[model samples]
Every structure is written in structure tokens, then in C-alpha cells.
Target chain A: MAKGSVVAIDIDVSRRLGDRVIAAHFTTGPGLTALFGPSGAGKTSILNMVAGLLRPDRGHIRIGERTLFDGATNLPPEARRVGYVFQDGRLFPHRRVRANLLYGHDLAPPANRWMSLDEAARFLGIDHLLGRWPQSLSGGEAQRVAIGRALLAGPEILLMDEPLSSLDAARRGDIMAVIERIRDELKLPILYVSHDRAEVDRLATQIAEIGE
Target chain B: MLSPEEWGIVALSLKVGGVAVLATLPVAFGLAWILARYRFPGRVVLDALVHLPLVLPPVVTGWLLLIAFGPLGPAGRWLESWFGMTLMFRWTGAALAAAIMALPLMVRAMRLSIEGIDRRLEGAARTLGAGRWHAFRTISLPLALPGVLAALVLGFARSIGEFGATITFVSNIPGETRTLPLAIYSALQVPGGEAMVTRLALLSVALSLGALVLSEWLVRRTHGERQRRGD
Candidate 1:
């Protein structure tokens, strides 16, 4: 019956380069928290562990009232109910945009399903591109579709790991604006990892600066 | 025009090859998926076992199959006792032998395709409330489809061309297990059978070439689909 204590991580794992260890311990309530750090700072690594994609060498991860990972209990990624938008968009190449967006909806509990297809598409400004293939989309359009896909999955927490880093400056601004809109309107907890200080400043309510 | 007897050999070869590919495909994909996606102990041993037929001489492979699947063998006896099925010297046994010969190529092609896929896509699927099976079905399998098609083509072609393994496992018997290659071999053994030899030889070449062309077309279609979508 507890909510809003979205993510608690006290873990140590090798950074992306695998040369050194980065230890982190933090807890954030419902809001957009930015993990700002330089390249190779292990921001994505931490996010990955949250999504159950990777396991921390030693630590506990509690999202909401659920103990996701520890010595005893390790929930699979599918059980975590975390939505992730990657840097590359990672949209299903063979699936049409609509199908990609609805993939998570297929498995999400009905009670937890809040966002509709039209609502997600319109919010992300991808209503018209739903029929097209992901490979055909421009960088900005693809990222929007990715966001829409994640949103439709009915996730308890959204993880954006430099979702805009691959976009050009103009596209970056557009995506950042959409992300801000999501944070304000959805009120879901998010861990947005990025190196752009301005992006962190503009959208993040809480900032955890890592690396240089 | 070919005689019924000549046509039977052609028809039998096609049937055996087609059935072999169908049977091998499920096993090939399962093994290929495991080899490409998971890293566990003795993975190399499993890989080696799958590829053993390819490396060994065809006669040796067939001898091994005969020992394992022959009516006197434990597996053969169990199958006969339990299911009333007998693989010894039957056309079905020919198909099994052909499937074994074709399996390595199919697995190799499928494994390459599976490996080429981005694992991160599956990761994305998992976060979206998809379990391991769902992610594999929607993401991994679809993305690797072109490769799978290619594997099927390769398997089919290899099955059609299968000679040594089939003859070794199940001896040539007309109307039962005498496929194109076996028929051709029999024709060559008879005196003044040079014309029948020529005809069967032409048929075998045409069939093998047809499979190759079909495989090539499949691979091209996949590539075109990907390119059309701008991948």
C-alpha cells in the first residue's frame, strides 16, 4: 500500500568500461530525477539494473513497495513494470509503429492500463506515423514513437537513458519538450539519464550528478 | 516424357527432402536460439554435437545413424514397441537421415541471423511487461526472419542433395527408399543403363538447382523487405 517511493538503489557495479567500480545509493519520490554524468559514468548501467536488464554485484533495489533485486529475490525485467526508452530508439524493426506501441499493452494488467493508443500517439505527436515502419522514421519521429511505445506499456516508472542524445540539436529540443510535458502530465516517476546540463536543468526536479 | 518408375524416384526425393526440412526446422531454431542467445556450461559441446554430421564423412554419419536408428538399436526397438513405428529401410528413415545431414547448415544460418539481431531490443520488450517468450516471439524471431528463411532454403537444398547419409542409413529399395540419388546409382550399376543414368542425372541436377534458386529468391526477398523499410 505504499507508493511514490519509486526507486531505491544502493549498489556497486563495474562502469560500462569495466575498469572501475561506481557505487550509488539514492531514493527519489515521484518526479523526474536526472542522472547527469559524462560518458562512461555508468548512468545507463544503473538504469539497466533498475529495469532488471543487469544485476548489481551487491546491493538492494526497491521500487515502490516491491523488492526487485537483492540476495534472495530477483524479479525478472518483465515483472518490474518499468518503461525504458533507449538512445537508439530500439523500436521493433519488423513491427509497424502501432504494433510496437501496443506490444506492452498486450501483457499489462487491465487495471494498470491508463494510457490509450490515441492519447499516447497524440501526446508524442506520432499519430500520423503509426502506420509506417520504424526504419523509415527520422530520428526525432522515431524517438517520439519510442516514447509512445513506452508510455502505452503502463509502466510504474519510466527510464529514459539519453533518449535524445542521438538526435540533432533541433530534434533534441523537440524531444526534451515532449519529455517535460510527460513529466508534468503523467506524474509518473522517471529516471532520465543524460549529460546535457541544460536538459537536466530544464526538466529534472531532482538531479544526481555522476562522473565529471 | 519420363516413365512412372523414373518419376517415382523424383517424387520420392522431393517428398523426403521437403519432410526433412519441415522436421528439422523446429529443432534447428531451438538449437540456434540457444547457441546464439545463451552462454552456459558445455555450450561448445552442444554446438559440436550439432555440427558433427557436417565435419564427419557422409558414410560415417550414416553409419552412426544406422547404429542409433536401426531396428536392432535401443531407440529403434523402443520406437517400434511403443508406437509401432519402424524407421529401418523405410522412406521415413531416408527423410530422417536427410534431416540430420541438413541440420548443421540450417542451424548455422539461423544462428548467424539470431546473433546479428540486437539484444537490446529484447531488453526493451522486457520492460514493456513482456516475458522472455513474448520478447523472443515479437522481437527476436521477427527480426531474424530473413535469416530463418535463408536457413530453410539451405536446409531444403542440403536435404535434396543428401546422398551418402540416406543410402547408408536405409539401403536403396525401389518404391520405398529409393530416392533420386539411389535410383541413379542403381541405373549406373546395370549394363546398358546409360540412358536412364543420363535422365536421372539431369533430374537430380535440375532439382538441386531449383532449390538453390528458391533459396536465393528468399534471401533476396528478405533483403528487399529490409531495404524497402529503410533498414
Candidate 2:
């Protein structure tokens, strides 16, 4: 595949769970590319490979001009400059919400930093909740904090791994609205993983259906 | 009340134990991090080596320390030649013996705490552009602190009560290597030394018991905090 888009994931990654084979080979462009698949279909695995959390068994993942992973050059996760919002809202428990949100900011190079902590907090509507620890936040509030955290790093790309999977239906829309605002306001590429068809139908600009 | 000489014994014990633990804490934390987070070749062997003191006879452990730390020994020779520091038959030697005997307990407590931290938090930090050291400093180290504190207390308790290793490695020398346990034993060797032994034993019991209770309370507080956070 040509290294043309702002983000590219034309790679083959396979995971064997006892007897089942969950494999993916897909590419995405500038906008939101949703990996829609059933449970255990390895949607998150693909995202992990892109984020440099898991090295792909074959093929390559290129974001902008930098190749994150391939045969020899498997860039470490910290160097990937890709913000990830995990489904479970993996906030640092000991840290206050403000600290969690600002964690990525210190490491992002001045050139890559497109936003500040205050801006992220304002955009995510998390200004009032900054002083509290993560354990106290509601699901929707936690997800918002997680998003703000990823965004503060000023990543060129964002990866949402079933970000709303753990939330109740009532809170899902609140987070969805925040995600939409993020997409509309930011110029970064996004790879959203989800099992919900309706969510993909609503937010995804491109769809790659994984699993045989 | 402890007699003047008895008071000296108690003071020496506290000083030796405190210095040993304080001296070894940073090294213990480094080892704990390695043991808890990494899987390298001979990992099992390294684990066994670290816990050897816990399973081995303290006298045997002291013998090992002596072999490595005596003035004629290679390590001891180098240390003595370079820094004028001799760790045999000195009060410093007793502290060294105490630290070695107590190391496993300290490392174990800290390692358990380090392992308990949600590794994904470090992963998250990494994705945010934080390097390994930065992630460890800001996330893993802070999260593992209570356990580290508990480890220090446990090490101190073990240090103060260290007997076999202290006796064998440094020997019981007053104003030098004779700590509380050695003093107790020396008192027992004489006829009218019962009262001295009794007072020293009671102090030892109190110190050990206090350390254990403090460690237990810290562990429980950490657990309670986790539960409160719904983690």
C-alpha cells in the first residue's frame, strides 16, 4: 500500500485463541475509520498494533511520514505519538483527574503539541472534575477525562478501542457527543473500534469489517 | 529500666538496624522493580538467590557474607583498600549482616506492591509520550510507595531482631558489634544476668510487634483505598 494518507494500517495481524482465528487486514484514510466486528474478532488487536502496543506479525503500519511498525523497525509505543482511549477508561487511579489529563502533555514535543491542558479540559467539559480522583467519576465523566488525557498529548492520530463499550445506554450518548465534538474540532486521524453497528453507522466515515 | 550498658546495647541495636535498612532501601527497590516487572534468563535462579536468606540458616547466611566481606576476601580487600572501610568485626559489619538478612523481606513487600499496580497505567503513560523512567517515576513508583514504606519497616524489624547472622558474621563485641540479641545471649551466659535478658527481650518484642502492626495497617489502608475507588 502507498504511504499516502495521514494514517495507514494496511497490515495483516492474526491472533489464535485456542481454536479460533481472529485476523485483520485493512487500511484507513484521513477521517474516522471504524473497525466494525463481532466480539472476539480482534478489533482491539488491530488498534494495539497501530498504537505500537502490540507488534504486528506481518505487514506495516505507517502514520503520516513515520512508519510505526514493520519487519525491523518496531517503534516503541511512547514514540508513536498516537493517543488511545481504552474502553475501560484506564485512568491512573492514584492521580487526580487533572494529573491524568495532563500526563501526555509533558512528553509531546512542542512541535506536535496542538492543544494545552486548559483547552482540553474546556473542550471535554472536565474543568469542574479536575480535582477529583478517577475512582469517583461516573462512567461518562471518566471517559471524558480519558479522552482529554489522550488529546492533551497533541497526537497526530487517535485510537478509540471500543471507548463506549462499558457505559450504560444513557451515558453512551453523552460520550458520543464529546467524541463527535473532538472529531469535528480536531484535524487528527481517528481509528475507532466498535461492535455496535449503529455507532459505526453514525460516526464512521469509512468501515472495515474484520473476521471471516 | 535497662542498665547503662544495657541501654548502650539497645541504642546500638536501633542504630545498626536503622542504618542497615536505610542504606539498603534504594537497592531493594531497584531489585524489587526488576523482579516484579521483568522476565529474563535465570529469573528463577535470581529469585531463589534473593530469597536464599529467608530459607537458609542465618548463620550460614552470615558465613556467606563473611566469605565475601571479610578483610582477606576479594570484595572486602577491594573495599578496604579503596575506601578504608572494613566490614568485619566492626559495628558497620553488624549493620551489613542485618541488611543482608532483612533484604528478602523488604524486596518481597515492595515487589508485591509493584506487581499489584495496574500495568495498563504504565502502558497508558507510555502512549502519552512518557518514557520508561518517566512512567515509573510518575506512576509505578508513586503507586507502589505504601508497600515500599511497609517494606522498610519490615526490613527494620528483621534487622533489629537479627541474631544468628550478627553473632556469626561480626561476633558479640561491646561498643562495636554487640546488638540487643547478642547482648541477651551474653547475659544468659552468666548467673544474675536473667533480669538483663528479660528487659532486652521485652524491648525486642515491642519493636518487632510495632513494625508488624504498622505494616499491616498500611497494607489495609491501601486495600481500603482501592476498594473505595471501586478498583
lDDT of each: 0.84, 0.86
Query: Which portions of model 2 miss their true places by more than 4 Å?
Result: A1-24, B1-3, B78-84, B226-231
Task: Give per-residue lDDT, candidate 1, residue B218.
Answer: 80
Highest-scoring model, lDDT: 2
Question: Compared with the true structure, what per-residue lDDT tens digits does model 2 show for residues A5-82?
Answer: 355545556656568766787776677889877887778877887777776667777775778877778898899888
Each prediction's DockQ against the real complex: 0.62, 0.54
The candidate that wins on DockQ is 1
Model 1 chain B: lowest-lDDT 10 consecutive positions: B222-231
Tell me the deviation in Å of residue B33 in model 1: 1.9
Query: Which residue pairs collide, candidate 2?
Result: none
Q: How many Å off is the CA of A177 in candidate 1?
A: 0.8
lDDT of 2 at B127: 92
Query: Which tens-of-lDDT digit does each residue in B24-55 have in candidate 1?
Result: 99999999999998999999999999999999
**All candidates: CA RMSD (Å):** 3.1, 3.6
Q: For candidate 2, give the lDDT.
A: 0.86
lDDT by residue for model 1 over A47-149, one digit each (tens)? 8888899877777877667787887888999988888999999998888899989988878988777788988887788888988988899999999999888
